[model samples]
Target: MEIYETQEENAWIFRIDGRLDSNTAPELETTVFRAIENGARRMVIDFEALAYISSAGLRVILKTAKDLKRLDGKLVLCAMQDYVREVFEISGFDTFLPIAPTAGDALRQVAPPKE
Candidate 1:
């Protein structure tokens, strides 16, 4: 998977493309964790081009969200395909993590101060 990150105002955006499986989950995790560690409180993860995700991928997302919450941070996911969204819903992630219809919506959902 490829991660293209950018900043918009105070929000950090990570646009991921390709598969997010056991092989590349760690790389993505490290990138995201580092971003959060670097004080990215409001993050919008774009999943429009992502084609797949494994259990490892799901774990990374969950852990990130938990960590963000501890820091009073926010994590938003946008433009997910139906297959991926189904996995998130079935895994109970949809309830814990916020999902917006678009990247703009995700960005707007971020709370102030930290963002």
Candidate 2:
């Protein structure tokens, strides 16, 4: 899988392309962890181009979310295809994790508050 990072105001957007299985999950985990280390608090993971996701991918996401919570940060997921959305639903992640219909929506969900 290919992960693309973009900065939108105070939020960081990570777009995932292709399949996220055991092999690619580590890469994603590392990338996200590095971002967190770099002080990325508001994040959005875009799954528009993602074709598939395995359990490993789910674990990475859950871990990221938990870490973000501890830091008082936020993570939003967006642009998921039907199959990908189904996986999240079946995994029961959809209940706690926020899923938006588009990247813009996700960004808005995690956007910094106005001063």
Candidate 3:
């Protein structure tokens, strides 16, 4: 998968393209972990271009979520296709991880409230 990362304010956004399976999951895991280690707190994963996701991908997401939680950070996922959305639903990931309709929505969810 192609992972593109950008920053908006304090939030880090990752846009995934193609498929995420066992082979590609590690790449994503490493990259996101690096971001977190570098002190990234707010994260948004945009799955608009993602074609497929395997259990390994789910594992990476779950791990990242847990890590962020331990750091007192937050994560949001957005722009998922129908199949991907179904996968999260069937796996019950949607219940815990915030899934937004768009990247903008996700960014908003991760953003700190204005004064």
Candidate 4:
């Protein structure tokens, strides 16, 4: 998978393209870990271009969420296709992970509070 990351005013946004499987999950994990180590607290993942996700991908996402929670941070996932959403639902991830229908909605979910 190809990941394009950007620092927004409120959160770190990652737009993923292609499949997120065993081969690509490691890369995503590394990128996310590096960002968190650098003090990123809020994150939004856009899956609009992502074609497929394997259990390995789910593991990476779960780990990232757990790490962020330990740091008192937040994560939002959005733009998932129907099949992807089904996968999350089947995995019971929908119970805990925050999912939005659009990236804008995801961003709002993780947006920094106004001063």
Candidate 5:
């Protein structure tokens, strides 16, 4: 999977493309960890170009969300296709995480207050 990082005001956006599976989960995990290290608390994982996700990918996202939540940060997902969305639902992630229909919506939902 390819991860594109960008700054939207105070939030960080990660636009992922391709399949995030066992072979690529570690990459994604590391990328997210680096973002956290760089002081990014509000994150949006944009799945507009992502085709598939395995359990390993889910684990990475789950870990990130938990860690962020502990710090009073937020994590949101956007633009998921049907297969990916189904996997999340079947895995019970839907109940644990908040997903938005578009990247803009996700970003807005979790955007930090303006100074």
Candidate 6:
């Protein structure tokens, strides 16, 4: 999977392309953990380009969510395909994790309000 990351005012946005499975989950885990270690708080994962996700991928998201929660941070996920959304729903992650219909909505969840 390809991870494209950009920093907003108070959030780190990661646009994921390709599949997130056992092999690719590790790379994403590393990137996310590294960012958190470096003091990144809010984060958004854009799944617009992602075609598939495995249990390992869910684990990574769960772990990241927990980590961010401990730091009093937040994580938003957006632009998910129907099948992908079903995966998250079946996994019960949709209960706690914020899922937006669009990247703009996701950004709004983490972005500061305009004056």
Q: Is candidate 2 or candidate 6 better by TM-score?
A: 2
**How well does each candidate superpose onto the true structure, as a TM-score?**
0.93, 0.97, 0.97, 0.96, 0.96, 0.94
How far off is residue 17 in model 2, in Å? Answer: 0.4
Residue-wise C-alpha lDDT for candidate 4, range 1-115, written one tens digit per residue: 7999999888999999999999899999999999999999899999999999989999999999999999999999999998999899999998999999999999899986778
The true-versus-predicted C-alpha distance at residue 77 of model 6, in Å, is 0.4
Per-residue CA lDDT of candidate 1, range 41-69, in tens?
88889999999987899999888888888
Clashing pairs in 5: none
Backbone clashes, each candidate: 0, 0, 0, 0, 0, 0
Query: In candidate 2, what are the lDDT values of residues 36-76, reduced to their tens digit?
Result: 99999999999999999989999999999999989999999
Off by over 4 Å in 5: 113-115
Evaluated at residue 39, the lDDT of candidate 4 is 91
Candidate 4 global lDDT: 0.94
- The alpha-carbon root-mean-square deviation between model 2 and the true structure, to one decimal in Å, is 0.8
Q: What would the per-residue lDDT of candidate 3 be over residues 32-60, giving only the tens digit for each residue?
A: 99999889989999999999998999999
The number of residue pairs in model 3 that clash at the backbone is 0
Off by over 4 Å in 3: none
lDDT of 6 at 110: 72
lDDT of each: 0.89, 0.95, 0.95, 0.94, 0.94, 0.93
Q: Cα deviation in Å at residue 25, candidate 3?
A: 0.1
The C-alpha RMSD of each candidate to the native structure, in angstroms, is 1.9, 0.8, 0.8, 1.0, 1.2, 1.7
